[model samples]
Target: MTDAVLHPDSVRARKADVPVVLGADGAPVDWVKVFLGFGGMVVGQFMAMLDIQIVASSLTQIQSGIGATADEISWVQTIYLLAEVVVMPLTAYLTKMWGTRNFYVVAVIGFIITSVAVGLSSSVAMMIVFRALQGLFAGAMIPPVFATAMTVFPPERRITANVIVGLIVTLSSTIGPTLGGHLTDLLSWRWLFFINIPVGLLVIFLVGRYANFDKGDPSLSKGVDWWGLGLMTAFLLSMQFVLEEGNDEGWFDDGMILWLTVTAVLTGIAFIWRQLVYWQPIVSLAPFRDRNFSLGIVMTFVTGLSLFGGTFLMPIFLGQVRGFSSAEVGNTMLVSGLTMFLSAPIAGRIVRMMDLRISMILGFALAAWAIQLGARVTDEWGFWEFFTLQVARGLGTMVAMIAAQQMSVASLPVTMMKDASGLINLIRNVGGAIGLALLTTILSHQTAVHYMDIATAASTANAASTGLMDGLTQVMGARGAADPEGMAAKAMSAMIRREASVLSFGDAFAALALGCWVAMALAFFTRPVKVDTGRPQGGGH
Candidate 1:
């Protein structure tokens, strides 16, 4: 190829040396290697996701084991997220330099090594350091898996592959907490990290045997965009620190938080400038120009919000509001996992047969309804009460995720697949972070406001309040408890707090439902994508 066509940043170009495989029907066939390659990739991806979920459930146990305070232990998760998001957008460039197979092999091996180090860690600081390293490699493994699915098969088979990817993604998150709780309860918390060893080894061997993607493009590395790298890293790291710390540190009220916020904004601007102007930008921003890709990314953000936000809120509601154990909280999510397992293949078929717009609209609509229903939750809710909600979440999640993936990259050229994959996945992760932050803030602020409102109303000499107090006093008297008046007041106060907490949860779910509706509206803007009949390679899919 000529220099102009050979430019790695030439979004219109594809290397001539790459091979394309087609089936007897004159469509690109799903390579047998894809099954082995993507399957193994899924395993590694599962480990990464499982690690996050496992730690979330076992946070208290881990904190006690490492002799860390509650505040300090939060960094174990914060640092991992920081590292993961920072590396996700850099995958395409890194793969070009190291070659896809070589890069993936190294990442898998590094992940295994770090998992062991994390398991053996003796101090909070040591665990954080190792976890950050693990997150780096783990994050690197994810984009490639998605990119592989997009390229491995024709548009016809791509939906199936995407569904499989969605299945593992949803399943890992659903099962993580329950499994982690069991491991920590029956064995040591260190076993959570140890569990990755055998799986990681298996993944490494499978990837080595079956990976057939691009080896590498040496020319792409000739002009490294160091300026772009610096600005991007600055933006991601500063923003992560701010997001994770802003709520606890009082947001912009703290001087350090304020300064970092400004720094993140400036770096963010500079990074955008570099990507638009620099010839060989580390991240390709070209995908956003396509209408379908851009709109689909919006839907992806909503999907992330629901997935991560629901996961974050459920445990807090169950564990704190209902006074359930970690194991019980995890058990409540099993319904979601089971539903996803059964629903994803059906979703894949729906995407294959129905119009893309209809598929996405249906998916987002179900998700919105599910989240809205979750708003009806009360303090008295048990596992059965959440059944329909979990079922809706699972079905909605599978449908939305599969349709969103297809819609996002459907119109992009093959050469842009790698960058587009990385960008789409990055947006999803950022969405999750933003969603979790918003939900947590809502819960805190709303709980305090509701408590104050109830307290104020209680202070007024209302007849209903008087009746409640009298009833409580009578119950205490009937039980022959000491200090009936004091016990009645305490009981009333606890009741007020519980009601306030449930109200806060309801508010959070309502907000999530509104977000889903907005995503569904955006789905209409995506340009229609037509599957090519010719035996084309990655681009047309």
Candidate 2:
């Protein structure tokens, strides 16, 4: 169904009167055209995100194939994320000039090229370059998809439209991790990229054939606030670089770290100012003037942190702590992906029938609570425990994520929604960056603090320590001598690691809990826009 905004005149018109596409008499939109156009979008988006996680599940296999160090291998994820975030703000401008129809098609083409290139890459450098390119276009494509939907959709069904979009997006989300993981296990890692070729080609054909909407003026997109985009990019890229390298470089003492910190701060400030004052601003800040929109933006930002942060952490836990293979970690997410896929439509239906705010509050609360449950997990935790957590996340995210997205956007003018939605995505990108950095740093710090305490305990130095000495004595006796001191030290080493694990997981849990509160607060403060029920008009700002 096209988005049906309720307006004064439209209140009297049946749902069929709403125009979703162009007509001489302003006839109702063709829902079939919209669904087909949108379906292509979902396919492309799903393909992109799927490639990312699929590669994740097969990292070990790729490492062996390409012969790169762990440091270099990190580029696979980092470069892709960087590329995607870098181009996000530009998407609004691009679509404005080019029309979403043209913009999305081109973006998909770029992504497809990179996907194919990645499959053909013979070296690490080539892979990184192509991956970055793919990310750039993929980044540009998402906002316009929604914008087109909003622009063409009728107002009354705005929330419902978002729910449908969300359901499709969720499907993409799950498909990436699930299919990618399964493919990685069944085939080699390179197949992950190779797999995109056929699907991408099909999308290209469909988009060309069906999404033939007229291209608007190109100048709108081309006159991007490059200054703004540049600064924002540098700030994000630098900050991410620092976070990724801080541990290895020994934190602030490193000269590179100091320079990056300075650059990032400067660029971030410039970016904010550009948004506030620049004429023909690359990004529009107008949507943020509304309290509901602003609050919703905050929720979206915080939720991004939780979403991406959890996406990063879960695989690490499965692979590093539990000794599961990369394939296993990916497969685990796949299971949760299935649950998410199933729950999305259900979530959409509920939102259509119920107050979205209630569903969102509950959803965010539940997701936060579930992540907290993960804190208590030991290395001994079975697959079932984590599976349960994923199911909870699947359901909660369905509620909070969709509710937040719809409420925040429903009030914006259709023309301006591309920019608004793009900006929201950008915020989420930054939030994900901050979340990942902060979570990793906190985990490391807490683990170190715990490790040091246990390692330096007086009991270890003293032979009289009860359990410590007893365990030591037995090991020594087995070695044919009572070397109590050495045995005590070894025992401390073993026990301290477990303590560190507990502390690290606890920190992650705490972070997720805080994120939930932020999302809830955003939802609470949002004021719903009053729709005119008598006639259909742009409910847009």
Candidate 3:
């Protein structure tokens, strides 16, 4: 054959009528199949994220259904998170072994089956088992979607893909409680898992048919790092257990917590060492060599802290302090979800137009300011009072998340995208775990401190305290209560507890605001990436 006939460009030129877009690797890009497959993965991602907090508002119902005590019921959520975290770092290795299409489809099918099993569970043990399996399967769905966004799309279209993924990440988690509350009220808590069936089948169909982004390397499975994988699992499971149960079980004072903490520290160190030295590491550490990736990982960790911390605190405040029902709390929380949805498109534009570091700084600063506003909350603060704060939070989260996601992987080689994506996600989850633990500890300790201070101040010596007690006693006596003074004292104690809880929430908000400020400062250290504004040079199909 002649040189012209043999040339790749000439070969493509001969089929001009068939129009093709070349990816970074010089392969023809099927935009339709990419999007269709990607859309399915995104939906799967949404389902997984949504499941994280979907049971939040309906925990009591689930507990009742399964005959679980309040103490045992929390394991339903905790187990899933623990299992999910353990599987995340291993995603890159698994993806290489099975290919993206096979790995993702198997995960979804497993998730769906476990979902059905979870819904049919009749006891707490059965529920936890199925939930853990469900989480394992669902964990496989997240990191690959992120890796796909970076690898499958060309540079110019990456921001758009990142924006969509960011939206799904934030929006689904934000609205989970609200959606769960409605579903539980209308149908039943069992419907939460059942709802995933139809949607998941659709995902399987789309992904199985169209997700052909990469080929599997069966050779990579030959020299598996069993030691590294074992150490990693032990470390993650122990660490997650320590974080999840530490506060509830009295931190270091509890024997199990103390032992687990030691195990976590020891195993974590060993796991890192194993990964660094192993010939075929289950999880690669090479991605950390990139400065931008390291910095982006830090920013993502803080984002998760703020995202999950804020989500956790608001519902507690609404439920405990304001006495809002699950539905009302969900309704109030919907403000942040709506704001995130509305600001997503705007965030995409800003990410494209602004320098990434500047965009990150702006985003983190806005979130910090908004959270500081929340620090001034009162017992009477409700939906309208939190409106502006939620709006700022929503906007800030979208912008920073998209920028962080881009910065974390954009500079890495295509070969490292999978590892980097998985690492980024893993760090974010660890941040969230740490944030929740710290916030819960602070809330509990601060509440006790505040309660004592307030109680001491409201003594018999204080005229206002005496007058209030007398007034309450007179009102109870007028209502024909036999023990007016005793009832008034109890009422005063309850009031003090309520005030203390509110104050503790404010303290938590301030802590989160401080984290945002720290993240904003760190943004300055990230190097700027050169933007690729040039459109893909190819004929339109």
Candidate 4:
């Protein structure tokens, strides 16, 4: 019944070799230790998720403090994401070599140290360096928590544990912008990093003392695949650089972007080649061969697109068009985050009562509808108008995440659990990066197109344009302006541009809605998981 007997040589199987604190009659340990251990891992996962989005709204303030140019300030996020994606998929191998518990504890401590260092940084360069370091450690900490859900817990509890983990992953990113906005307004941008200290320390203390489920393997230390790692690092670094900077620098036009594109292509091929041939690959690619897992990865990708696309768009819309403050923007999103949290139990119940396929179909339908509704937004709309959209997104997120997660790894062999967790998370992050990039590119292109058309129409002698100009001129004349027509023209142009921006946002939302529909179609490809027998059944090892 133990993992050792089932998998024999799984890294998780090695966990059985560790000395466990026994309970009554040498029975399995109580839930207290499991809860403590799981709780600590969850905190670490929370910090990792929070750190990525925490800077979403605070970039402007941090830029001011560090005297960074706009381009340099954007790298604050790019570097962290780059580091995270680069390190994420390799967690399975690293944890195997270092031992899961030891690697996790060290990553927590390192993440905390880097957080303090980032807060103390005087220049943008220093901050970027420290944040990259923070991301490296944070990325390593995340996958293990999910792997723990599958490998460390008993079968009956795996579903519950996964839901809890899923909620943290979804909610942390959901609340990130809001939390960052408040801390920046109430204190300083540095407080964002400093806030992690106490939480990180607490997680460290608990994990260090109570986590005895996973043990390290010294044997994996031999024959470490440094070449595969080097190829992976190169590929991720180059690919992320291109994705993050391609739009600003002019996609294939910029020499740096062009060269990085070539580099990424080459390294990506090489990494895949290495993984296929290497005896000790840095990241296992075998999991993708499973049809269900492949569908699950695609679903997770769409999940990232929905979650990250919405998260990226709302604040920009509020800040630019409506002139809302960071605090206000965060406050609007806080409701959605709470909705996601409150809806987790309902999602959990759905997973237990309904088939994952049905639950996922319903989730995707709701999410697509929610995003489609945002395409109807107008410049005058406020928080109340966005309420339904937010609530629907929150509920949809909970259902989709819980279902996708359970479906992703439910059928993989126990030995492949670590690989499944790491690769699935890697896909999610990569999907988010791709989604944000795609949405931003669309917004920029659509805004320019809309602005040009609006400006062209206004320059003509159309009745609507002329009437608007005439009204503005009379209003300005009544206000005692000398050049009423000129002032009116300028004001009218501004109005046109603002409307164009709003329309551009609508286009972005529509695109995301289409993405959700695509996810819905993919949900049908997922074979039903029958759970009515009171025991979860997975595919063979």
TM-score for each prediction? Answer: 0.90, 0.87, 0.92, 0.90
What is the alpha-carbon lDDT of model 1 when measured against the actual structure?
A: 0.83
What's the CA RMSD for each of the models? 5.1, 4.1, 4.8, 4.3
**Which stretches of candidate 1 lie above 4 Å from their native place?**
1-30, 185-187, 474-487, 532-541
* Candidate 4: tens digits of C-alpha lDDT, residues 51-133: 97888878999999999999899888888889899889989987777766788999999999999999988999999999999
Candidate 3 CA-lDDT value: 0.87
Which pairs clash inside model 4?
A: none
lDDT ranking, best first: 3, 4, 1, 2
Candidate whose TM-score is highest:
3
Global CA lDDT of candidate 4, please?
0.83
- Clashes counted in candidate 1 amount to 0
**Which candidate number would show the highest lDDT if scored against the true structure?**
3
Greater-lDDT candidate between 1 and 3: 3
Candidate 4 vs. true structure, TM-score: 0.90
lDDT of 4 at 357: 80
lDDT, residue 245, model 4: 82
